[model samples]
Target: MLSEKSMELSRKIIILIYGRAFSFILSLIIPLVLTRLLVKDDYGSYQQLIMIYAIVQAILLFGMPQSLLYYFPRKEISDRSLLIKQTWSILAISGLLVITLFGITSQTMESIFPDHHLQPFIFLLGIYIGIMLSVMPLQNLLILEDKETTAMWSMICFTVIDIIILPSAAWYNPTTLGMVHGIILTSIIKFVIVIFYIYKNYLSKLETRESYYQEQLAYGIPVGLTAMIYVININIDKYMVGLFFSSSVFAVYYLGSLWAPMFGWITQSASQVVIPRMSKAHNNNDLLQIRELYANSVEKLAFIFLPATVLLALIAKPLILTLFTDNYEDTVPIFSIYLLLLPTYALNLGWILMASGQTKFLLRLAMFMSIINIILSYGFLTTLEGDNRLLGIPFATVAVTWISTIVVMYKSLNTLESTLSESYHWKKMVTIGAISALSAIPIIALLSLELENKIFLISSIVIYGITFLFTSFKFNILNDNEINLVKSFLPFKN
Candidate 1:
């Protein structure tokens, strides 16, 4: 039975990863094509629109999704339907607040942009905010409920729709608003599908009541606050950038941020399932399952993040060139600095902190993190005028970010010992890190030889990646289950 459970867990993890890979590929293709098709100014407006959407999304969900992700995974969900209804109630309240604030601030936002009357567009976006609020937490339920195949396939199918429709919209009339229209239309379609799936597959049978709503609110609010704080920590940098930098420079920073920070999604996806899975694992007083989950999550990321960040730093030029037209030179160095976050974020999840049932404390700790990020960003963007100095702002901010996260994580690690193994996985990870770094020697050599074109850079990257994977898997550095999880995707490996 234990073997079967492990197998099931492993299988689910693989399916989720594969689904994300498919979605990610299509995601890349659409963005890459659109970036090429749209001019810098058009792309800049589109990106700004996205930033506005992100902020709106954050507030619209009323942080209910974070609460859902936190508690829904537990085996002790005595009244699932009631909890779900309560979450929806919270969402309703929060969504209204966000829209109201947007109303008051709409004109000021347009003034800041200096080129667009964001009010109409923000209003268009406001209508869907409630729908979006449901979808994200519903996604949380799908993953927690182990509806992997449904969720995975659904996302891929949506991306396929996006891939076809978005570029078509651009081709017919490649204006900035046209592109935005295409994206919204596509997202609305996906949202409809998700709502349908969530109800049909999971939420339909749950009972709803007032008591459960109150109980979940009592528990979920702290988790939601933690989520908001974490978001504040991460998004605050971008917010500061928009304030202090030129619109053009803000555009460059936005584009460069496209890759490195979102790479943390690798961690996010695994932890999305991991949190619920770990929460369900009988870690009440025992540490084995918790340790297994934490160590495995951390270790898997080491292989992913270390080289990617280093290589991203090396390949920023080609990446930006390949993804965007060569209208901008600022993204490369700025992205190189931003790429430093790859390793730091990969190592610890806010979920690990969640799994230990320290939501309030984590929220407190996140306050410190947000404080640090704000102060550093202010220093770089304003006090020191680092944004004007090209990559200097990102560089300074990245340094501060890494230091702060490391200090906080190390402090958090001791508490996680209940969930993480006593083993020195970090040490083993370092050894693998060494091997991965060694594999990159060739790429460094190529760089020195001034092989600057896209092909050489991309080819060198492929070589280094293969070399690193070979080194890690050939020895016992990655055990059978870890290797098999990766292999499950490959036709031959199966």
Candidate 2:
């Protein structure tokens, strides 16, 4: 029988998944519209701008949002107000510091992206970052309040607004700067909503706690810095690509290099489902539960990820051409290379490390991986030319990610008092992956026939879907209980 906590976790995962699915749909449509409406260079510049925000926001939040999950449950009801207030105070101060730093460093920053006129945008960027940073703690507060559904709705609203605004903004002004304005406007609107919600729900209940800030800072800074390193690891390739190729070329690579949303959404949703439970289990020193959750999560994630990875890799060319048009045909190989890393993301070690308060280890791992990425990216850029140079980054990424995954697994296993074999079954993982890959063979054969590009893509997806589902169920890739859990959320059951 499932425990109440397990049932609640399932419910939250369901809510978050539905929210992410809707957001993902909007996400797909937005890129389609913007990639076509904006020029290639403009799209590339927009991507770079977003990368900048990602790095800055990751740094500025400093992982304080994570602390809420750790600290909130321990506090008394009256003490909650103090925690909320202190968190907001710290975020505001950090946001101000970031804005001032950016204003002072605008010229030096401008030199990095030579083609873009960043001088004017620097001030706007600072404001945008400031507003975003200030709102993050409050946003996390919602999750702590068990209002993840509310937070998810806010995300959906913003995405809806983005879809309506971004392409129209690009169409009207038809420039990178104009799209920047659209981004800023959308952010401002979202920021206002967050502020209002935070104030109404949390601020009114606030009280003073001089020591709470110190506690949150101690816990949050390392996590934040670690996250910053992660940002660098993922994004250094973009800088390398931009430096070597034109903005137009960078745009093509960027589109190709996007993480598959199916994998991302599943990983993210699973993390959300497991982290709090894992944290509670760790707090109680229940190694047994930790090991159980860890094993179950990897198995479930592998079941979904292995199949999707194989399917995407098989149909990369048709998928790229159909979605981004023939001009993006070069993206096919890069996309395929990125797909190879999908399995690495199946590891849920970060959640475990965070739950165990081993964030400094994550920081160290991120540093090691980031350095490796930079060195390899540089080597590739110097040694190779054209699209091969872009492909090299993801190749390097897959290697580094695997290395990091192994180290994390070894370290985490020692801490949990479990062997690798006990935590997750290697034989099962390999078997599942092999089975999923073999299932794609018939679909690949069909793709060789001459057909309309869109028709071919659709037919390939439909054929693969039916084949994989029938084979997987017949083989019980996911067992009966797992199958029923998934079906509970769907509208219809077979």
Candidate 3:
């Protein structure tokens, strides 16, 4: 039987899974509908708008949002309220400065994007950014407070709001501005929901703590810087493509790099839940608990994502064609290369550094990694244009991710005073990788025959999924505890 702690963790994980699932499904629909509704150039413009918002928000929020996970669970309730107040103050102040700067340098900002309309949308984007930065801490607070069900419900509500508003907005205006309008409204609704809940349940008189503010900023600044660089790590390629290539080209590149949300959902769900737990353990100086949490989290992420990524890779071409239409057939290789990121996702060692508050090391790693990623991606793009151009971004991503994961692994072990062999289940992950590969044999065999695209895709998914799950279960890829945790959520008993 599982311990009480394990059961609680499992319950939190389930709520997070639900949240991610809701967000993931909603995410898929918005992109799919937008891609189909708008022209390729327009779609590309919208993506660029989102990319800009992401970069700005990463800067605006700094690391204040992450500090919630680090400090909330450990802090007294009064201090938690003060922390929230201070974090929001930072976001509002910083947002004002940035928005003002953006308004003043509107021309400079416009020059970065390929479209003139995107320049004006910057205002809406700025407002959305401010709202988002404000709302972020509240969302993380829910997770920290272990209000996972409430968090999940909030996400579901937001999804419902987006689904109803965005498609209609896209259908009517069908332009970048329309999309921005829809997004702004969506953010407003969510902001109100989260803030109202926090205020009703958690907020109190402003309890100012200067030392707490300093501590959060000290820890958060480096994490924020790391995140800012991570923006470069992930989005620099798109920026490069958008800057050099045309809007239409960027659209294809963007679509190609669209990772199935399943990979993100699994890893993100694990990270969000694991971080608070690990932070609590680290605060208590519980080394054994930390070790178990780290190892178990990685294994679960791998067991869930490894097979799904492999299946996606095998059907990358047809999948892209089916989702985005044959116009994006050029996205096949890009999507295929992007699929390679799955294995690397299994090496989520960042949680160790994050929970341990070794954030400066994370900043250093991101700095070095981002520089290398930019250079490699640029070198490839310049050298290989045309059909081979999109390949550069994913190739750079894969290489950089592998290198960063290795470094993080080494640093994580060093931080934990453990070794590679003893610390992580390396052999298990490798075995799972092999299992995922071998399980694709049937799908590969199916590819040899001529069949309808839908039939081929369906057969590949069904065949590959059954094989992977059967192998995982038969080989006991998941431990008894994990199997039980999963079974608890199912209708039937284990």
Best by TM-score: 3
Q: Which residue pairs in model 3 clash with each other?
A: none
Every model's TM-score: 0.86, 0.92, 0.93
lDDT at position 84, candidate 3: 72
Can you write out model 1's per-residue Cα lDDT over 1-494, one digit (the tens) per residue?
12556656666766766777778877888777766777665666667777766656754564566666656755355566656766766776765676666665665667776555344466545544544565567556677676777667766887798899889888876867687678767767866776676567446877544465565665566666666666666667667766655566667777776666666657667777777766656356555676676676677677678877667666677777766668656677667777777887666565656666666776677677778777776766655543454455566557656776665566556765532245337776787778877887878778777665777667887988888877877766766776665565454121
What lDDT does candidate 3 reach at residue 388?
Answer: 72
Off by over 4 Å in 1: 1-8, 75-78, 107-117, 171-173, 202-210, 281-283, 383-388, 417-423, 448-452, 479-481, 489-494
The per-model lDDT (C-alpha) reads 0.66, 0.77, 0.79
lDDT tens digits by residue: candidate 2, 271-315: 755776778889899988988888867876787778878888877
Mark the regions of model 3 whose C-alpha exceeds 4 Å error after superposition: 1-4, 107-117, 205-211, 260-262, 479-483, 490-494
Query: In model 2, which regions exceed 4 Å deviation?
Result: 1-7, 107-116, 137-140, 261-263, 490-494
Please give the RMSD of candidate 2 to the true structure: 2.9
Order candidates by TM-score, high to low: 3, 2, 1
The lDDT, on a scale of 0 to 1, for candidate 2 is 0.77
